[model samples]
Target chain A: MKKEQMTPTPLVQAIGLGSAKAGFSHWWLQRLTAIFLIPLGLWFVFSLAGVPDYSAATIQAWLRSGLNAFWLGLFAVTALLHARLGIEVVVEDYVHTRWLEVLIKTLLSLAMASAIALAVFSILSLVRGA
Target chain B: MSQPQTSSRPLSPHLQVYKPQITSTLSILHRLTGLWLAVAAAVLVLWLYGLAFDASLFQALTGFFSGLFGKVLLFSWVLAFNYHLCNGIRHLFWDAGKGFELPKVYRSGYLVLAASLILSVLVWLGSL
Candidate 1:
């Protein structure tokens, strides 16, 4: 009895009738992006605040800096990704209308995809052109 | 296969049935701020287009943001961002299995609110 108590029993394998989706991955990626965005986002706000003016050249020159460009670009990409994931959950949870859910989510994905692509392009253009 | 003739499962009452508490309010606010922030973030990225190929668009956005309506939106965005950030950190701590005690939960909730307000003020001042 003592030996049996000392030895750990194998845990029961669990099963469920849950939706067959990558729920864990979706949750984890949201957290990962959130963690990444914290510093990247803070830097962005501060950097923009520090700018002398709101001129394009000033903005362009700032983007010319290697660190600035890198962090800003990372922030753009990470933020959009996080936003995409966050909105998906919101739609899934609240939008009970099946067709509406699918339609909104599809449109959202397209917009986010194009936005991300444009963000990367803008960052590259700014840094290299500068 | 046949289903049960009568529904035996109990259904939870709608949110309106319960009195609002700090926990429920804050929980909903987190989601609200999160959704609102998503919209703002999308526009911010879209604004980045002004940086690359659309000078006129950039100028227009800049002007629009400097206007009263823009200021209102920006102010709310800052508040939302700060609240979401602080509350998110609180959530992360909870995920790590700490602060589950009732008193601790209430204390942390207040702290999140205060911190969000302070951070929002600071950002607004700094950016001015």
Candidate 2:
């Protein structure tokens, strides 16, 4: 009796069948955020460096400024997103246990969410002078 | 804890004794970059927290960051960030089962180095 050969799906594709494609989306998002951050990150470093006597007022004013806010917010959000994705990869690669992986991934997501919230809150405080 | 007994002879570790391969170099560099990123993130979190705090703290941090040592650390972070980001993407391709050929391995290695240099120069110029 000849049994038909069945092809095993690639690991990359296998992720989606059980995991709802979240892993792939996260990986892709990390790359996308990295692409977005490169120029913005450079601009931010330069912008901060050129400022004179970077006091609290000066820093607040910069964050409050429309130009600075846009870049800062983007960087903050994208950085957290990318970090979450990166950390998730590290966790998945090294943390072999099923429950541990899920726990770590969940914790990472929560941390990223908190960081973004803190960043936005901080920026808002700066903008509002509070 | 029992340490593994070694033969009563001098022995070199794999890295010290073997000719370096791309995969080995890439693995070591990846871990190094990861450690660098961890340190960089700590610095960044402090900076952000400083921003949230009152003016004196912000000024203090800014002053320190403008100093020579601060600049060097910042430069190192920049290099590590660029290198890791580039190499991580390369890993993604490998994960997808692409670029396993010898030629592509060398090509991507050079690409990572070149891209890091260009980005670093652009960053320095922007800073100045």
Choose the strongest candidate by lDDT.
1
lDDT measured at residue B50 in model 2 versus the true structure, 0 to 100 = 67
Where in model 1 is the C-alpha error above 4 Å? A1-21, B1-11
- Each model's TM-score for chain A is 0.82, 0.78
Each prediction's Cα lDDT score?
0.84, 0.72
User: DockQ for each of the predicted structures, in order?
Assistant: 0.38, 0.24
Off by over 4 Å in 2: A1-20, A49-53, A97-103, B1-19, B27-35, B38-42, B55-60, B63-69, B85-101
